[model samples]
Target: MEMNLDSVKVVGFDADDTLWVNETYFRETEERFAELLESFETKNKIDQELFKVEMQNLDLYGYGVKGFILSMIECALQLSNHTISNDTLQEILDVGKKMIAHPVELLSGVEEVLQKLENKYRLIVLTKGDLLDQERKLEKSGLSKYFHHVEVLSEKKEENYQNLLEHLEIDVNEFLMVGNSLKSDVIPILNIGAKAVHVPFHTTWAHELVSKEKEKSTNGYLKLESIKDILDYLKH
Candidate 1:
């Protein structure tokens, strides 16, 4: 990985989970959502149905707390056969609002890693979600000063990375993406001929899970236990 990243000039970081806590909130919300509909169905069933609704509405709503809230509402309506009370519905909205209003929790060693790499590399944030929400989080994180650019992508496929890199005038060979999700951060960046470092978070959303075979096939990307470990490879 060090050999591959020796030429890297720009480092793209994934915002949620990589730099700070994110999926844990969604998990907590899911538990609350399940409880809200517990009388209608088992918690397991509610979780499955809500996930299905979210997947069904993915293209329509994209990824973010807003879409998740809508999915939960839809699931509640379906699970309760349209008999869901207005008060319960309001509670769902409040839960999502709370997630949005939740404070940013930076991961361990995140600031230290960013600070060390800031002068050596052009740091940028490339994340996918609601633009306004992402920007709001970045502002609250107070780590935005270290980045040269911040992009809120609707998706993180190869083309998205390719286009953004091209627009930013960064060569793929000279770029390194560091993030938590292998599906979003590592795999796509590796596929695009760029270098990537996988810094796994304790919790990952189901949509971001990759198969073991898929993980094994991908070569050249480094998987580290902590973000701070990257300094050993990238630091001069």
Candidate 2:
């Protein structure tokens, strides 16, 4: 679908995989988690069980490393039939700690795009996760200077986007969101009468994935090969 770039005034960027390396750490942690449970179950089964527990605990823990750490521990207990050792459990917690301490690695062209667009548009950050964790990453990223506002929503539904736009006093038609997840970044923004740009990361968390049919049905958003490609249309 064609984008009305001329009408775009405010640009919202998603944190995590869109601007920096995020999912890679999660994937690595998952691998470590599976390895810790290999004695109790196969890697595949461990992965599935962990994901199941994570989904079940979504509302209880929301999202981010803390929840994921808890889910991994719960999954280990379930897979091992409560026989998992304390050492293995400690390893699982360490996995999450490492993830939290990991340095932010910005994606290719992230700084260049932000630098070019900083003066031309009112840039903001719109991401959902543990508020402290997200804020910490933003501070570490050194990209905070470019953003006029940063919001860490509990969820990224249409209403969430609508409410944020209203709170910020930004017209829906004049706001454009750019991010890596179609589910979190593109679809909701489109549904809320705003524009979005989808620049997919190589690895997506299972929860952030949208069905092929849903993706195909969604329209009115731009899909770019890289965040840098956005410049061609946004004209920063």
Candidate RMSDs in order: 1.0, 0.9
Ten-residue stretch with the least lDDT total in model 2: 1-10
Lowest summed lDDT window (length 10), candidate 1: 1-10
lDDT by residue (110-165, candidate 2, tens digit) is 99999999989999999989999999999999999999999999999999999889
- Pairing residues by index, what is the TM-score of model 1? 0.98
Give the lDDT of residue 133 in candidate 2. Answer: 96
Estimate the TM-score of every prediction. 0.98, 0.98
Residue pair clashes in candidate 1: none
Q: How far is candidate 1 from the true structure (C-alpha RMSD, Å)?
A: 1.0
lDDT of 1 by residue, 137-203 (tens): 9999999999999999999999999999999999998999999999999988988899899999999
lDDT per prediction? 0.93, 0.92
